[model samples]
Target: MALFNKMLASIGIGTAKVDTRLDSDRYLPGQTVQGKVEIRGGSVEQKIEEIYLTLHTTYIKEQDDKKYTQTAALEKLRLNDPFTIAPGELRTMPFSLVLPNDTPLTYGRTKVWISTGLEIKNAVDPSDEDFIQILPGPIVHAALLALTDLGFKLRQAECEAVSYKLNHHRPFIQEFEFIPVTGPYHGKLDELEISFLSVSEERAEILLEVDRKAKGLAGLFAEAMEMDETMVRAFITKQDIPQMREKLNQIISRYI
Candidate 1:
């Protein structure tokens, strides 16, 4: 009993407590995430200036060929404004958050953390970080599998901050690079870069950049192209490995 009391004190439960639970452990892009944030009062009453939930993801920023870790806030929600919790009281607040469609799904299981916090002026700040697993959707997985089946190997993956100068919402672009399979075109293509934009259940924009190796007569050049929703859907779902390889080869041949 004495040890239990000491453990509770270490957590500042005598002040305030917070717990956030998600409705579902696994979620898809463009889906609403439902959760409950429960706050339990401690030995004494406390005044909370505000109660809010924040969603964050980690990325790497590259500058001058150097990389640095960066944490970005994706979304935020406010539950209450200046609320008072009396001693021996327990309160639970429900929250429904719609995750961004373009959120990157980790290769396998990515850990995404959400924080529920109560802001207090004098007392220790009480907060909870919940780790959620992010799984890749069928469309995304299919595309990658097709590329792999075609003999293209994954080279690198990274998230880049991109500005179109015409879009309203700031977009973070995740780029996947692959090495070409076999053929004269295999060595001819330095790498295949793919990007997903405006990603959602209904539609997604696909962007491709092909870096071509320079021939004796041809100079090194890169071609960039954007595919519409209909084309993207067709390419991901309908095309097979051979067809995908041909489609990519055709695109590369035109430039060379």
Candidate 2:
């Protein structure tokens, strides 16, 4: 019986399993997530090399005109040194992870999760995955509200590939698409897309891509020449929210 039990444990049939339990399901950027990882031993004694946590999220990637969802690790944490878990033993390790300021929120099909794993020699590793919701920081919320106040209705929002110049850890960004159906530029513009290039407590860089509607012969000629789309960069601060509408309107006026 002893020989059979050791054999089973070696193959992970009776090894330790890891599970992380978070206090909450929703977290804001720059906030701390408190949790505990519970390690439960199976039918026999097993040696756990270490315990680690990884923050992962899914984003869209394009290859050969085909879009695919890919998982990326945003952060990693190793909790402890090697330890032995006796048969049917239960152990708990408490932990906390600091959410990054640039972390993208959970919106428009985006998913964020944490994976906890047990590292054991000569055995199949055991892991647990739990999804969490990310909330937008102050700057992003303010910008969205300002656009709504400007008569722009959100049409679509998605996470898509972005440029390296944006200084982002992820290869993609969350783009908010809007259209002015009743605003000052209703008939003049087709749509507007906004992306947060970089954001901080004191400053943020936003990208605005505007598509204009073609009207008469002159407008059609400009459209045919591929001049109906314009991209503008805006450097703004929280204090600028009161005037952000006017600032964006001025930029649209030039294209309209």
Which portions of model 1 miss their true places by more than 4 Å?
1-13, 108-111, 163-168, 181-185, 214-256
In the predicted model 2, the residue pairs found to clash are none
| Candidate 1 accuracy as TM-score | 0.73
- Note the residue pairs that clash in candidate 1: none
In model 2, state the lDDT of residue 33: 82
Q: lDDT by residue for model 2 over 85-189, one digit each (tens)?
A: 998899999999987776777877878889999888877899999999998777788888778877888888777777777667678887889998786878878
Give me the runs in candidate 2 sitting further than 4 Å from their true place: 10-12, 164-168, 217-226
For every model shown, what is its TM-score relative to the native structure? 0.73, 0.89
Backbone clash tally (model 2): 0
List, residue by residue over 1-256, the lDDT tens digit for candidate 1.
Answer: 5455435544575778888988886777667789899888876667888888887776666779997767777788888878888867988889898777777665422346678888976667799988666665656666666567556788777766665652525445677777877655476666767767656554445666666665553242222222211111123333333365555445445643
Best of the candidates, TM-score: 2
Clashes of each: 0, 0
